[model samples]
Target chain A: MEFTSETTANGVSELSFTVDDIPGVLWSPADATGNHPLVLLAHGGGQHKRAPGLVARAHRYVTACGFAVAAIDAPGHGDRPRTEQDEQFTAGIRARLSAGEPIGPQVATHNAALAAKAVPEWQATLDALQKAGHAGGPVGFWGLSLGTGIGVPLAAAEPRITAAVLGLAAAETLAEAAARVTVPVEFLLQWDDELVPRDSCLALFDAFASPEKTLHANPGRHLGVPAFELASSERFFTRHLGEGVTQPR
Target chain B: MEFTSETTANGVSELSFTVDDIPGVLWSPADATGNHPLVLLAHGGGQHKRAPGLVARAHRYVTACGFAVAAIDAPGHGDRPRTEQDEQFTAGIRARLSAGEPIGPQVATHNAALAAKAVPEWQATLDALQKAGHAGGPVGFWGLSLGTGIGVPLAAAEPRITAAVLGLAAAETLAEAAARVTVPVEFLLQWDDELVPRDSCLALFDAFASPEKTLHANPGRHLGVPAFELASSERFFTRHLGEGVTQPR
Candidate 1:
């Protein structure tokens, strides 16, 4: 929660900090008259918090929607020391994938564990941000792929999360976590995803316990998710967290 | 759970079956066996129930120690079908490891998920085996490496497990699971393990709630664990579950 750097430009400020190895960043309207609602973001697997996709989404949300944005590198993905298990498992995964074997079980196993650890980390991050007066008001979650697996459970456990943009995830085990998530959710999926089967993705969406949830499935591979989906995701957050204000970008 | 094959040789019968894709095998002594004490075996990471080491240990328990031994493939391994998560995670792991990067985070994520799924699976297997009258009397556990991560929680939750052979596991998260395990344990560790750090391994053993737990640290790398350790593991199980009878092998 220690802010290391702060830079302001065109009414939007970028703040960076080191929260015990969790390299984190915050984006807020620099000239905001008051504290803005925060939207805590999570990056996908093998990607850092500042991945182009996450950064763009954070910027768009803050610039166009008058919301504060925050994100951190998930445990091992960014500027963090890799542990021994990560090494062997990564090697094992590479070896198996090179052999063209189905790696869903491996992926599920990895994601599940990551999700478990991440919930606590996310919770801790929120607490630290709140204590430091960097985060304010209602919080929403946004993560696809690995993000959904972890963020779904995080949002489920944290009552403060009023809405979520979750998708691009599938696993029978994740269904258990999804069942706990009761917030309004905008779920996305790729119909022809080579890694996640259509049935499982659909099954995951169906398993969400949220009373007001929507599905937005596109036809493509895992990486072919349409760009338009992010717009809807932003809108979902805006509807739940905003006073219907769309500030000029 | 449902027996499909039974073979008898030299006062021992090996039973194998498919319990909804969880291939399992049970080794029981054939002669005058009033329901014997059961030793539920869990193999190491990336291994099946019938790995030579596991098979040899199971055989020893049944023949030399007069106990019934049972084991099944963990979710992503052995005779079980690998799912999409497994494939992707495995590939991601391999790619990271081949790049000479530390893969501890990756391995931790995978092992955490495996451990989460394994506990319930092991419980279900025992329940089914007991229902089918293939498992009886006192129950114990034996697992190392990935086995310890999963098996520790299993033994903790199952009050019937009076003793356990757990080791070669280390993670701050797994320590939470270990704190719940109060059974008598014979914990093993290779001082120079390539995967798990020595301090973390010791910390895991220290986290166990068992008052009668013992640590047997050997001088070797993970793969180079001496065969003598297994002998001691067998002895520990025998001391707790053994009824002063060493049946002829």
Candidate 2:
């Protein structure tokens, strides 16, 4: 683990780092000393680790809860180099769009493939972060869309994750993985999502084995989740990961 | 409206009053002076104005947000006398339960009758409260189950209500009324509800005309709403009715 850059603004410290060539950034209170609850944020498809929404959310979590927020680029996203597989997947989506065919199946297939590689990278990063004493407390996962595609499997396989806020992905490829996730979950769904069928999203929510899972569905297209949800998510993390909380529900 | 009793405890003032023959209670900050946003609390079937859940929520709103909360007994509920119609409805429900029959249709029919009488009483109560200067700001409505039955019609007919937290009923009797409601809504659904069919609840949510409606579904039976929802409702009102808020969403 190595930090390549560090800056402070608005009482938040931003540190850019790498773990085995995977580029990522961490945000925390500028004057922080002891370990804080850490949240791993995964970006949507075609978006990088530093996407505007991710940055804004990171800032809110840090300033409001004094928590550490981190994000890393996916296999072919951000400043990372794209392999031939990534190129082929993009072409497939474009071809489906031109033909007016639903692209969900192809997208799910590619996401599953990407998760195979990305999950190990995420695990290595978390191990490195823990070793460096930056993150060792209760952990949380926040991801939607392609992020959910990757997050379902990651949370299922990662025992360190205590809670997750995930959604906007279908159930076809993720239900089995979702069934393995027993931690508390907050699932988001777009009622009129263009890319994913509403039933599929609801089905995925149904598959979660977590007894404390809650589903928040709003009327919008895929990218149009209401703004109030961000505040809701902050409160969720506070409830599960704040001071004196040591058990996973 | 005439005040019949008043008491103060834990920084909250509880005042009992009546509009015509209908009895109700008002809760507000003990030191409250001048107008504040008011939230109308509707009790579920077989419950009263001062039900345990209602009182707890009222105290929280008053102390946490400085908001005034009020609750009124349904026509044949709380301290009010049960008429012949109420007696027959109760008998019918008891019979259905004994025979192992679904009572939703009968319950909806009875609720519709109760709502017809309760709406006018509520309007009169709101008018009297506003005339007395206790409630003159943005108004919010919170109710579920039997409360939702009455609230669907009340919010549709009353123009002062700006936001509502409603659910736990079906679309069989409330779909048309829900379509006329344009205020922001936070709808709750219990996933494993024994009384209300899940599909019916989903359909009722779909009928809301409000552009900013959100559905929060959790795993539970009819009376098993999780504790976290109360805090979430407080935030919903804060967003739509607190401070410098005059317009209904």
Candidate 3:
């Protein structure tokens, strides 16, 4: 594990790092600090670690909650090299979209292949972060769309993750993994999501074995999650992972 | 409206009142002087204006947000006199419960009858409250279970209500009314609700014409809404109704 670059702005310190060739970024409060809760963010399909949404969320957590947030490029995302399989997956999606065909099933298949490689990468990164004292406290996972595709399996296999906010993925490929996840989950869904069927989203939420799971569904297409949910997630993590700085102060 | 009684406790001023013959209670900050956003709470079946849950919610809104809260007893409920029809409704419910039959249909029928009277009574109460300067600002509604039964039509018919938090009733009797409710809404659903089928609740949420409606479903049965939801409602109302005193300060 090594950091390649660092910068500080707006009370947040952004550090770029790599572990076993997987590039990632970590955001934390700029001031010197002790160990605090860590939140791992997974970007959506076709997006990288520094996608605007992921960066905004990382900054929100770091500044508002005093938590460290990290996001790593999936196997073929961000600054990582893409394999032949990644090329084929991209071509398949383009063909389906141009044909005006539903792309959810194709996206799920590609995401499954990506998750197979990405889950172990996240585990290794968590290991490195903990060793460096950046993440030794309770941890949370935030991911949606392709993120949920990867997160369900990762949360199931990684007992280190105590809570998760996941959604926008199908249940057919992830329900079995979801059944194994017992951590409290906050699932998000778009009522009019064009990519995933509403019933499938509801089914995936049902499969989670967690005793405390809540589904927050809003009316809009995928990507139209209302802004207020970000605040809700802050409260959720604060409740489960100890207090962060009080928000809306 | 006539004030029947008044008391102050825990920074909240409780005022008992009657609009015509319908009994009700209103809660406000003890130091409240000016009119503020109002939230009207409709209690569940067999519960009254001062139901423990309603009172707790009223105080939370009053002391936390400086909002005036009101709840009025439905006809034949609370301090109101019961009619022969109310007697039959109670006898029918008792028989069905003992027979292991679902009481939803019976409850819906009775609530539909109650709502017919309750809606008009509510409008009159609002009229009086507004005239007396107790509630002249943007209004909100909070109700669940039988409260939803009454609230759906009331929100549709009452233009004063700009936002609402409602759920726990079936759609068979309320879908049309729900379709007319264009105000923002926060809908709640218990995933394992025994009295209402999960699909029915989803259908009701779907029927809402509000472009900003959100569904919050948790892993529990009726009467088991997690305590965290109260805080969530506080934020929801604060966001739509206007800033409340910052909570968790």
Give the best candidate by TM-score: 3
* TM-score, candidate 2, chain B alone: 0.96
State how far residue A79 of model 2 sits from its true place (Å).
1.4
lDDT of each: 0.78, 0.91, 0.91
lDDT of 3 by residue, B153-247 (tens): 99999999989999988899999999999999999999999988999999999999999899999988888999999899888888888864332
Off by over 4 Å in 3: A245-249, B244-249
For every prediction, compared with the true complex, DockQ reads: 0.01, 0.90, 0.96
**The best candidate in terms of DockQ:** 3
lDDT of 1 by residue, A80-153 (tens): 77778778778888998999987766777788887777888888888988888866678888888888888888
Error of 1 at A25 (Å): 0.7
Clashing pairs in 3: none
Error of 1 at B185 (Å): 62
The docking quality of candidate 2, as DockQ, is: 0.90
Q: After best superposition, candidate 3 residue B242: deviation in angstroms?
A: 0.7
Q: Flag clash pairs in model 2.
A: none
Instruction: Give the Cα error of residue B144 in candidate 3, in Å.
Output: 0.5
